[model samples]
Target chain A: MLSIRNLTADVDGKAILNGLDLEVKPGEVHAIMGPNGSGKSTLAHVLAGRDGYSVSGGEVEFEGQSLLDLEPEERAARGIFLAFQYPVELPGVNNAHFLKEALNAQRRARGESELDSVAFLKLIKEKIAQVSMQPELIKRPVNAGFSGGEKKRNEILQMAVFEPKLAILDETDSGLDIDALRTVSDGVNAIRSPERAIVLVTHYQRLLDYIEPDVVHVLAGGRIVRTGDKALAKELESKGYGWLTGRDEAA
Target chain B: MTTGEQRATDLEKVLRRGQQQLAAGSAADNWLSAVRERGASDVMTMARPDRKQEAWRYTPTSFLDKAEYAPVVEGPFGAIQPADVEELMLGDQQGTCLVFVNGYYAPALSRLAPGQHMPQVAVLSGQLGDVPAQLKAHLDGIAEHHHVFAALNSALMSDGALLYVPRSASVQAPIEILHVSVGLDEPGICHPRHLIVLEEGAQAQVIERYCALGEAVYFTNALVEIILRPGSRLSHERLQEESALAQHLSDLHVRLDEGSRYKHVSATLGGAWSRTDLRLNFAGEGAQADLDGLMLARDKQLNDVHLDIQHTAPGCISRESFKGILDGRGKVVFDGRILVAQDAQQTDASLSNHNLMLSRSAEVDTKPQLEIYADDVKCSHGTTVGELDHNMLFYLRSRGIPSARARQMLCQGFAEEILDRIENPALHGRATRLLTERLMTYSE
Candidate 1:
């Protein structure tokens, strides 16, 4: 469903992603694990087409189309979703209104009929329960004065509402307690289907415990150095990334 | 003579012609005659404001010189239908409406709640027996003597709405005053003086609306005087949506007694040139005042707002917030001044001015001044001028909203702080719609 080939990118003229390559097929769940400053978040941002990132070389393909050339909104319309680590706090903007606007925008771009307020409210209410968010929070401004857990759940609520084909979860478990972590993971697992591809970029292996991935990749120094199955996470958790890097050097 | 003096000579002709025209419409009433003549002489004494003056530095009054001014003739456009006045009404405020066309009251277009339940409402010139003493006492009290436009309004003012609430009267419904200007063969002018008084423990809400019926080259000089007694409360809203060729100038003077509350919202959406001067004085202790304004100027339109609040007594609180959205070479000028006297201890005052510039050529000038003689007082002022936040734009765009829709939402959000303060839901909705329509006309 998604492919990245030698993705050479820089932030502020400093190379962050150097000749990184990855590929994901339909209905597969992949986890990209790395230590701090290992370019995990940069890959998420680059895929989302965020500004201020200069791509020195390489290209990204999504469903056989060049994704790097599209704008952020175009990428979103084309079923590319990035659950941000830090959801922006938009003052004076109602959460429900924003979500509805986003949903309608995607619908219009896909040549589908837009949902009215009544229909949207019904749909969002069910999703609201799916993420276990308080209904009143939907009426308040987006993420303004929201708790850390609430903001993460709000992001998942948006993801569940949009129902993207390719969902990129970037550090979705950060700042979440154990109970919230379980709820969010269950919500993500419930939405998984044969037609969707999930890419989880995380620093720790704790999130993988709830929603087990079919493939595990360790990203070190801006490139994928190790690939294995679910057992690899447990092995890495016990032995640590230093063991992997030493073996890589020896090899 | 100095340039200031020379400019005054040329302005005097236009003001004098208006005074003569006003005199031709009125009867031989001693008190009314005396007030008009004194007003005319006051125009000569104050002359006209020039660029040299600090208050008029940013606003150029040269457009007044280019047009000849004549007083609107009486009964030339016949009577106005209530339907015509309804177009300018805010939402569904059907309580009481007083309509004035070309500075003359139209009884057919005006409505009042049946019977004694209605507060005392009358025209200034129609009834003289009970109005003379009150008019004489408060007419010249609020507006300063040096303002050239106020002086001109006082000189040539013919008729206006007068509302008085008795002691302990709590008016639930809002009273609306609509001033409509019709097309004229010559450039015309109207000076309407409004007087509102709330007695002790009284409460009331008033909306003053100014709009033009057709394409007219006219000038509307409006003066509003409000006196709130001890423990009284008043909410005053002024909405101006005049013709593109119209020029509007208004002076608002408010005096608050002990434990009184006064709130004002000024929304300026139209007019070629508009200026409103608001002066508030806290005469007794424990008074509260809030001044909020929102202005939209486009296509060479200019909106100027000047506000002055004086904390003369102890334990008074005052707040001033004004915002402007300028596009298409439009301009806005906001000058706010707060004064805390020595005897006025424990005073709290804050002033803020924010402007959003949609076009590179659009201009905004904001100046805030605070003078505190009391050692124990809290006063602060801030101003900001910038475009929409790029980060916010990207955030919205990332959610699949188009760039233009994102910018519009942010701009509307920036303005909602002031517009949301409108208590009437219908009025609030209408005003929001009007602001959006006005914004869509400007090329991004």
Candidate 2:
């Protein structure tokens, strides 16, 4: 369960998200569609607790607890996962090692026993299979020289391993080919369960074809203008967001 | 210029304290008395190292603060390495094993590698070798060059180590010298001196290590003199890793004879305030000298490396390369030089120093100098200091890797280039462990 009550956020004092509100329950998939400047990516950053974003107004509650007060790492420890639109490339940091550290850090923060190298490796090997990633790729520096589609898929793989309670996908499909999109959606669908919720942020309806959303919200002018069903996504894909909102947008 | 202008600065206070401590002991108890008697009252007078001093320019001597210095210590340096520390602090190379504890040679903790041709390593902890017949001409001859520390080392060396290789003998194994400066409860001062001689056509490898243990605040005034006979080839490595609680001073004097090949590599990863002054000279034609150094400094650590290469003979080649990575409030200074004598024609030399600063607070100063009087000589020098590549960082972050983790990996990669130069597996592993620890602690 999650709630955003008139949430307002800004980067370097410039407002990016203004009075935006959205909610999702267990097992529900919600998609937010917006044009270039519709604050789509800003929502993902705010939910992930990225720094440099000042919350000038409003509040955000995740599972009945205020989320704005938590740190990015703290939110991560609490099972709030955001698939970064741009994953960082770590030169000498092995992918498997990085994942293991992240997993162990979260575990340590949550008062759980840390997994040794052997057990962690076995678990990641299985997750890599689910995401159709190779073991060697996991051994190399995290996403070093990785293709754009591979980076997007790796984000999903990490989400699978962490098993976050609320998964926020931020334009994860932008760089993916059709096949990659299908595989990524398949990976997302496999992790879908009644105890977790998924928030999908995208402008294209193509991802909706893989894992159809229960609700589709139209975001414009830094606010949520409309909330509709899956058919609404198909309607926007055909007519575009121009008829939906006659606002000035770069894209 | 005038004695009145030279007041007792802070560094002098510390040095005088050392002098008094040395004087209190009987001549029979100490070996450096003759040299201590020759102590310079005007440590400040001779200590005038202004920006005009080429080697002292990049590294502002003002950093030492003519005042804020502590006294040298006299006991076991406290636990610098953690209890669960990695096993390979020193590699498993075969040869005579020389160990130094708090600048004092610790003979109990060393074991020489079993080899028929390997040179015997002996501890001159108190008195050095009475000049040997074969190396007598070159011994101390190279030590008399220009370093004030070398002069002081020649005058006061309490205890040291000696490695002697007979003429025409080829040693395949490496000789290891390990120094552990205890910096805990009992602290005073430690002066470690090492003398290595390779006879004509002899071949050998030697490793010099300075590790600080515990929390002792002391002085490690170390001098290692290396002499290579004609046609001899020697491989040497020096490692300095101290905690952020002590002062380290090390000087190396290296000389190569005609047709001899000499290589010296130093990996400096940690210290509170440390300086490595390396002076190398080529005496004969066709001789070669290669010097390489690496430093990883974090926190408020200050690391300075100064190198002077002199080519006095024609047909000689000398190369120098150094790299430094600074983080936290750490500061690093590097100075390298190549000198070609007027008659030394056909001399080839190259010098380069590169630095990477990971933190805004971290600073680095690097200078590479080349002086050539022989028109037929070929010489070049370069120095570069900058931060990590932004494009490389962006490339890593684009792959879903967190920004923090990505930055860390890039730092490690930059260090790996230097660590890979080592051929010995054990040595590589030990240095890697130290390098990784430095990077991790600095990033946080």
Candidate 3:
């Protein structure tokens, strides 16, 4: 469902992702684990076509189309979703109104009928229940004054509502507690289907415990150096990334 | 003479002409004649506002010289139907509606509540011969005539709306004063003054709207005076949506008595050149005032708001917030000043002005001033002029909304910060719709 071949990207003329290559088929879940300063979050942002993250060289393909050439909104309409690590606060944009506009925009781009407010409310209520988010939160401004846990759940709720085919979870569990992690993981697991692909970009293996991944890849210095099953995460948690990156921790 | 003196002389001539036009239709009442004469003399002696003046530095009044504006006489009032102005009415207000067309009261278009439970309403022009003593006292003493436009409004004032709430009466419905300016053959001008008085312990809401019928080259000089008696509360909402070819100038004066409360929200969305001067005075102890404003200017339009708040009594509080959205070479100015007198101990006040520029050439000039003479007082002020947050923009676009729509939403959201303060849902909805419509016209 997604392919990245020697993806070379830079941020402000500083190379972050150098010659990184990855590929995934439909319905598979891949976990990319790394330490701080690794290009895990950069890779997710590059796929989502965020501005200022220039692709120096290489190609990223999604469903046989060049994803790097598309705008962020275009990528989103083509079923590419990136759940941000730090969700931005929109001070006066209603949470429900924003979600509805997003859903309708994507639907319109794909030649589908738009949902009215009543239908949208009903759909969003169901999604809110799926993510275990407080229904009242949707009435307030998007992410404004929201707790960290509530913001993470809001991201999950948006994911469930958008139902993107290729979803990249960018450190969605960073600020979440154990209970929130379980709720988020449950929300993610419920959206799992044979027609979708999920890529979990995380720093630690804590999130993988609740929703196990089929493949785990260790990213260091902008490239994936190790690939294994779920056991690789546990091994990394115990030994740390020093052995793989050839840098000793005590140094 | 220098150019400043030359312009001043020219403006004085214009004011004299307007005064003559008003005197030609003079009523028989000596008191009314004296008011007009006082206003005319006050404006005749004062020099025209120039760029060198502190209050008019950023705003240029040069456009007034280019047009010959004659006073609008008793009517050729346009043949307007109720349906033409149906959209301008607030949906929730079911009390009284006073409609004035081209500075003259249109009784056929107005509706007053049937029973005696409503506040006393009258037209100023009709009451010139037999003016009530209470009306005369309040009208003569409600506001000062120091402002140039306020004096101009007084000199040219022919008709207006008068509202009086008796003591201890809590008015449930809102009173709406709708002023519609219709395009005339000549470039005309009108001065519509409004006086609202709430007796002790009385509560009421007043909505004052100024709208244009078409693309008319006219000027609307308006003045509003509000007097809140001790323990009284008043909510005033002013909406100005004039024509693009029109010029609008307004003055608002509010006096709050002991323990009285005053809330004001103004939205300025139209007119090529518009300015509003608001002065609020806390006369008695423990009074509170909240002032909020939202303005939009684009395509060379200039919008200006000048506010002066005086805390003259102990234990008084005042808050002022104003926001502006400018695009397409538009210019906006916000000058807010607060004064806490020496005798006004334990005073609390804050003022803030924020502007969002959508175009490279758009400009905003904001000044927040605080003069505290009391030892025990809390006073703070802040101002910001910036463009849209790129981070917030990207966040919205990343959610599948297009770039243009995303920008529109962000601008509307910024405006909602002020519009949300309108507690009346119908008025809030109307303000939101007007802001949205204005934003849509802006170039993306």
Candidate 4:
């Protein structure tokens, strides 16, 4: 339900994403695998509508609407979620309070009834435990003292709460251990449904073992060079992307 | 002498009061008379502070024109009271609620509050008999010998809040004192003195609020002294929502005895020129003190606070933290020093002052000092001044919060330290609302 055409972006006057294009339909899982400098995180940040980046040339459409014309909050209201590679630490805003504010903002934008504090507290008790998160974590300032894994799990918990139509997971499994990886992958898989689409951005084929993707695209030199089914991931894991892309393994 | 001549000639209208009470006064009254005369003579001698003085290093007195100020002997607005402001004052004693028409106490317009533990207040002049002896003894004792304005306050002081707590007695609720100034006639002056004595094992909370009622050219010189006996606890809050054109100078001295505790918080929101000098003396073992202050200045305003915390006994602890947020060319200065004496070992002290300057023209200067004479003591201090972090702003915006709202939330977070100390949830909610209001006002 998302289409990216000729996405060319620049950060601090250096080109990062060059002529990147991709698409996914509802109920489909797309995995974009690339080398270190393959611009995986840039695509996620660009789609998330983060500032300080100049979108040189690109057309991003979500559900037949132009995404570039919308603000970040507007994008969130339209069911677009980006699980950040590194979560921010809001020192004074409580984690539960932050989530409640975001939820209410989206609900208000959509003319839906919003949940109050009592209802939100009841909502978190179950959702936090579903991801094995400690109940006290919600009471502390947002990500103030959270570990790397707890922060990622919190991102997933937010995804579950918002139930976004499209989720772009950016290196959500990079720093996780095998146990954390399984938990995160299971969390993502648990939310899989016919009406939702998943875009998994990663540097390895290890996470593909848990939540299999319908399509795997090989990205090199800031652009996608190859697209294939799930076996392509295993082939690349065994042979690497240098053979098919004909580029030096510089990054 | 020419300007002083004009000032004295002008105050002849106000200083003419108290000739009768002046005939029959206490020993402290005689001392106050001498102090006031010294203030009149030294109005020129009390030089505006420069950067050369150690205590005035971070604070420059370029804005204060000593020549423009004259000693005021009486309240200017004799019989006028503004309808815009409300005074919800309470005291622990029983007496007339001595009101002020301008800066002068109008004993006629004032009446006594209800019962015991309700404030007993009156003008120090006409009805001084009902007040306890301790009140009269120390009413003029809180002012430091060297403070020009404080000594001036003692001299021509119109009226003040005098309190005395017997041993082991605690005032249940907060005691609020409001000093309102009304009229635009001539540049006038007000000296409000307060003396709070907490006997052994007594506890109390006192809040002092000052607000200017009119466009009158005025100055407020105030002195408050708190004496906490052994095992006594006291909390004092000082708030200033004065008019933009007014000048304010305040000095507070607190002496805590063995095992006594004192907590003080000051919030300065408005004033063209506002300065506070505070000193906390821990003279007995196991005494503790915590001083938390927050100030928000905007629109070319100025706010300055200087504090000294001295540990004279062993096993004493003190924490001093003050923060400021400056916008629109406004300036702020916070200078705090903590002194640990030779015998004051096992002392734990920390002082920090942080500022957020929203504009390039807005300025904030902070100095945190520690002088430790004993070994094996824990002492630390730090000061930071900076603009907003763009990364944090961007992070908030990317999460669906608008850029303006993101800035507001981040600024509120910067101010959260002081807001967290508000004990009551309703009060906390009010502080949060004020922070957000400042954000919006800054935006406009």
Which one is best on lDDT? 3
**Model 4: per-residue lDDT, tens digit, A1-251?**
89999999989999988999998999999999998877888888888888777899989999999998788888888888888888888777767777887888788888899998899888888788777777888888777889999888888888887888999999999899887888789779977999999999998899999999999998877688899999999998888878866865532
- Compose the digit string of candidate 1's lDDT tens values, residues B1-444: 112332222557767676666556657334566667777788788857888998898888877676666667777755567787676766666668888888788877777766635467777767423464554566556666558788777777778888888899988888888889987876777889888988899999998888888778788889888999899999887778888888898888899999999988878988899998888999999999988999888879999998888999999999999999988889999999998999999999999999989889989989999999999988899999988777777778777888788877777777877887777776677778878888877667
Compute fnat per model: 0.45, 0.15, 0.65, 0.37
In candidate 2 the C-alpha lDDT for residue B263 amounts to 82
| Overall lDDT per candidate, in order of appearance | 0.84, 0.74, 0.87, 0.75
Residue-pair clashes per candidate, as listed?
Answer: 0, 33, 0, 5
- Tens-digit lDDT track of model 2 for A117-176: 899989998999999986688877777799998888888889998898899999988978
Comparing 1 and 4 on DockQ, the stronger one? 1
Error of 3 at B262 (Å): 0.8
Best by the DockQ measure:
3
Candidate 4: which stretches are off by over 4 Å?
A111-126, A129-132, A177-183, A236-251, B1-45, B48-129, B181-183, B212-217
Weakest lDDT window of 10 consecutive positions for candidate 4 chain B: B6-15
When summed lDDT is taken over every stretch of 10 residues in candidate 3 chain B, the lowest stretch is: B1-10
Instruction: Choose 3 or 4, whichever is better by lDDT.
Output: 3
How do the residues B146-234 of candidate 4 rate in per-residue lDDT, one tens digit apiece? 55566556556645767676788866656555677664544566677777888889887766767666555567777788888899998
DockQ of each: 0.60, 0.11, 0.82, 0.48
Q: Give the TM-score of chain B in candidate 1.
A: 0.93
- Per-residue lDDT for A61 in model 1? 98
Candidate 1 positional error at A249, Å = 16
Order the candidates by DockQ, highest first — what do you get?
3, 1, 4, 2
lDDT string, candidate 2, B1-444, tens digits: 123332323545556666676666545434334444454433434554667877666555553442343344444333333332234245455566666666665545666566553464555543333434444344454665254545445545556777778888877767778777654432344567778898889888887877765555556778888888899999887778876666677888888899999887778876677889888888899998877778877888888998888888899988888888888888898878778999889999998888888888988887777888889988888888788876555433332345576567677776665666665677778887788766766564
